[model samples]
Target: MDKSAQTRRNRRQSATFFTLGLIFIVGLVVMLSNVYQLDGLTDTVHDRHAIRQNTRLRSLQQFQAAGGRGVVGEARTRSVCIFARDGPAILHVKAVFERLGYDIRATKDDDWDVLWSLKSPYVAFGERLSKLKPHQKVNHWPGLGSVTSKSDLATSKLLSAPVGYRLPKETDAFRAATKANPDKMWVVKSGTHRGVRVRKQVDNVLKIRHDANLFIQEFISNPFLIDGRKFDIGVYTVITSIDPLRVYTYEEEILLRFCSLPYHPFDEAEVNKYVVTADYTPTWEIPSLVEAYNNFQYSHKQALNLHLGRQGHNPKPMWQAISDSIREVMHAKEDGIREIVRKRFSHQNFFELVRFDFIIDEKLKVYLLEVNMSPNLSSGHFAPNKWLYEQIVYNTLKLVGLASATAAHPADVSKDERDMLVSLRDIQVASDRCASAECDDNCKPDICQLCQLCRTPYFTDSVKAAFLEHVNRGNYRRVIPKPLEEQPSTVDVSKAINSTQNNHLMTMWFRGKCEHDKTWCT
Candidate 1:
């Protein structure tokens, strides 16, 4: 009677077991689907993060290349070669590059192609500043330097000359004329207005053309007096970048160069007996000094007239001179020069730093002197002083993004705290004197004691002569000469120390202009 009931119960139990197995299988499929989706999401996030990091790295590299990093100590991307002979300019760049942790390769090669090929930022022209017209452009900073270009010559009569006639190789006649009329005012026709100390030669004129590879300028009469010694101003400026180039006169130094021999005052009896009595202006009357100078030049021939009243004005004093407006003008001009250089050359590796040299006449007229790409940068030279080198390091670091004011001591001070400190300093000093109150003035400021302006300074030749004499006396000193590769074995000292074979190192005749002469390099 119970057989049918037992069979139905067994079937029921089997059905329940099968139903539980199906539910379990469905749950397992759902869990596997969720796991796969999660894995895909994780991979997508990782790829996005990788892309972001790559973009960030590229951006940082770009900033470094553009000198946009705001760090104080860092490294540069490549080595830079400074092609200079002497002075502080080269040292400053070298020191700064080292401080910034860069791998530097210094060279004195006049071949710019080698420099460019080596992947340098740009070669610094470390000489005097040259004046450029408002519309003119330069490769780097123009007023602080000059770049070689056919276009810069369109308006520059001095730059536009016969290929072989740029700067005349000889100043013999001019020197003789100056010696003949020791006190006469003369025209120095070369790169810029230097100053007149002798009369212009009527027949044996020294005409400076563009291809002479020399710096030529007109030498105006400097009649100002300071303690009875003649002096000139050494204005310091810098051009940071060429593409959007900038120029600035961060410092000025005055040089009081007394004549090698001083003159005695004429006696009263001597003055009364002369047909052409000398009219001397007292040092106090600055304007009268100019008038007296002009009066003396009136009747005499060009050479004699120029030298007429220079005797009384001989012993001038050292004085730094520049207006605040001029400083600003110089800075603006620097930017203009950079923009112009970029537009003109369209080559990124043309030039960088330019130190423009200038000399002012008694009339306070500013005249361009010469343009230097490779300025002097030995320790004694002002350009490579410790302070300037520090700046170079700071800029290089900022470019590389390795160090910054924030990163250096970031843990010690909060960003707000650091900013507040800077803001407070800005308030205390004001914008004009923020760098330093004395710095804003025209005093002769230089790098170190070695470069301190001398009370009695020697001309370039004199310095070279004195240095050579010192060297001949068994003195061991570093002297920059033409690269050993360029000079003959007799002129090169690389093989030996104090080699007698290279005793008389030949100096560039007129300065570094011959080296910069475009045709010569070609």
Candidate 2:
């Protein structure tokens, strides 16, 4: 009886152990399956997330490539190389680029989207310009001396500039002109010496070294005064293209420099009475402008406009005349600019910023005095000018596509979003024009050559560049290629024979665009 009981107990113990093992194995299998399922779910989420991220990046790239019209996403940080030495003059430029989220590279670094040099780099860094990618930009044009050079400008005979003659070369002419009008006050200016000396007597004119690079011109005796102080207006001008010759002037505010001394009593000896040197009087110091500028916080242009308006002078006509004069001067010097641009590998890589100084007569007539290349951007002389100079740089960069309000995009992104000038041969409109009854595919006739069908790639690219500029220009106003409706009555189209064929075409294109959409005019 004891042997049977022991065998039964052993069987019961074995059966219990076997049941426990089976339950433990089942629980382990279920747990492993749940873990695998969780891992698979995470993998799916990761794949979905990657797909979404890639799609977004692709869309952003496409948007940027298509001229950056809409909202932007995360963009690769671009680099700016300030080629000039670090100084107060370029501090605002660097700060603005930094504010726009650009990586400021050392001056020695060649890998940069922008190269901002203090002077024209055509002679020094020209080889770099040839190797520049479409996205690269340099802040200077090649032959800017044509207008900036005092001697060249004086000899240009531009209607806007005062009557002048070059020294040594035109010495006889200058002597005869001064002799003809002995009573008229003449001034002698040289490239090396920025200051001018009024010469009432011919002896002072003869004293000037004949070999020196000098210019002599009739001085504006009756200068328009504010509180008996003489002043000159400095208009910031930007030239974006040379082939079609696009010119823009900062319309927001102009740099107003007033003489420290009074203009009355006819003091030829006191240079401060006639010239606006670096230490010239500030707008805050001028009685008539101080109230509007200091108290009311009015801009220099606004305060000047107000003062002029109150004195029975409308600033609109004066500004328009100034704009016209700018256009005429550019037109007069277009050939020289084009000649220099023709030698460049890519003209699109270069742009220019200059200051056009003009003096106003008592009758509100504007006269172009001189053009300053690499004009001072520093506000060390006047603290209030910091804002104005910074804004000018920001706007100029925006206008030239160096900086953007939104995410940074390639500076060379074609703004021809409408593709108006893109691949004329592939466009249906261009195709139709080529196949017109009066035209052949070759477009042999001059009239047919001007059509889109036969337009050269250079002209097409120039038009595209111009259209892009027009889109990006914020406060800058286009002065050249004036719209037909807005053209002053004094401008004679027939007399503008020096204008290039491309310029004429651009004028027509802009005129047509403005007619169809008034926004293009602006």
Candidate 3:
């Protein structure tokens, strides 16, 4: 009896020990598997970061040695011809060459003597260059032209009217209208036949044409604003090649021009001059003040809204919404224009710099004001401010194969250069700033400019890794779960039927019980 009991006890103890050991081994393997998974994830993330770092390094190198050219030692020689209207815009172009150490001379025949056509100092031709117009011959060399006849080309007419168009000249009739309505805008015009002058005004501007037989558009009022201040959107697209006229880069810079309301205040002397001077218009007080008066008398409600507010009511404060709306519309139109070139003229590249003008209303609707093909870049309003223009010029040179490959990378860029880059990027972002709207506002260049300025190789690899790391540390990963695959559940008709029957029975029983025994006391 003792041996049998001993053997049974030993077997029970052995069974218990074996089961416990197996359980412990299973738990250990599970824990090891989890550890392996976590390590693998971390390693994968690190590898991704390394690859991104390598890519960014490569890009930086490419940017520095733009077009694979090393540093530019001196300006080179190149030949180019440009057609443009003689105006303030041309003066900016002249300044670009003078700064680059090039000789710029305006020729009687409407040609500019540019020093370095190939990485040399150059002049921005001050002629009206336009897309090939209807009923005009395609300009093959020196670019498009309005001068068809050899004699016309020989004359200043060709250069004076490159688009074969001219705006109206000032006249007595126009002066009278202007005198009658000094605040209101007026139009002037001129025409010619067989080189004979014939000028007159038509009721409709659309029907009128200048001496070059081309219509001249009147400058419209820009009513767009920012924080109730007047502003314009400058689409700075770079033309890397004019012969091919490829647009290499596209940027939108905002020019927020601060103008006081039509009637905030006027200097005492200025007001006295307007009041006492004979040259003063019927009511030459302050434009803003006059506008305020008109608004109050005609639209009392609007005047009240513009005058009464915590900010002391800005009657004609900057209109940011309108400014953006105008840019959005122009962006779409420019896309169409670019497409026409790509499809019609075989230009597939983007412009290096292009600036469009727009005005917006209180409702945020944009209106096309005018197109500034070449904006001013004078000393005060220099297009390339300190570091800002360096990027433009550097990027332009890079695109044209004039700089080193890594010209885009700003790491090696001088501190001053980097500051300008930062400002340019900041401008883009600031332009996209809106009180309430999607970031995709016409000022999307803001994001691109910032990315370039920060030298973050975009959101490709390193960016994603950094983001994930932050998310994990911040517990964001727990909130944002990985996507799961959708799986269809098999239907159990019998179960469903039974469940329905059970519910029906419960309801019927409850009703019957209520009818038979009100309180179920019995």
Q: What tens digits encode model 2's per-residue C-alpha lDDT throughout 212-271? A: 577788888999999999999999999988888889999989999999889988788899
The candidate scoring highest on lDDT is 2
Residue-level lDDT for 178 in candidate 3: 43
TM-score of each: 0.34, 0.85, 0.28
After TM-score superposition, what is the CA distance of residue 46 in candidate 2 from its true location, in Å? 12
lDDT preference between candidates 2 and 3, better one: 2
Tell me the deviation in Å of residue 146 in model 1.
4.3
Better of 1 and 2 by lDDT: 2
Q: Give the TM-score of candidate 2.
A: 0.85
Clashes of 2: 0
Segments in model 3 whose C-alpha atoms lie over 4 Å from true places = 1-210, 213-222, 225-231, 239-252, 257-352, 380-384, 398-402, 406-522
User: By TM-score, how accurate is candidate 3?
Assistant: 0.28
Candidate 3 structure quality by residue, lDDT tens digits, 1-522: 699999999999999999999999999999999999999989999999999888877765665554322232323332123244455434545444345444444333223222122111112422222332211111122321211122222222211111112335433444455456445422222222122211223344324544544333222233333333343333333332222112222222233223333212333223221111112121113343246435444222233234334335452232332223222322223333434444434331122233334444443334433333334343344332333334344444333332322233212343344344233333222233332254434324323322323323322222222222222221011000100111221211222211222222222322333344442111
Q: Kindly report which residue pairs in candidate 2 clash with one another.
A: none
Which should have the higher TM-score, number 1 or number 2?
2
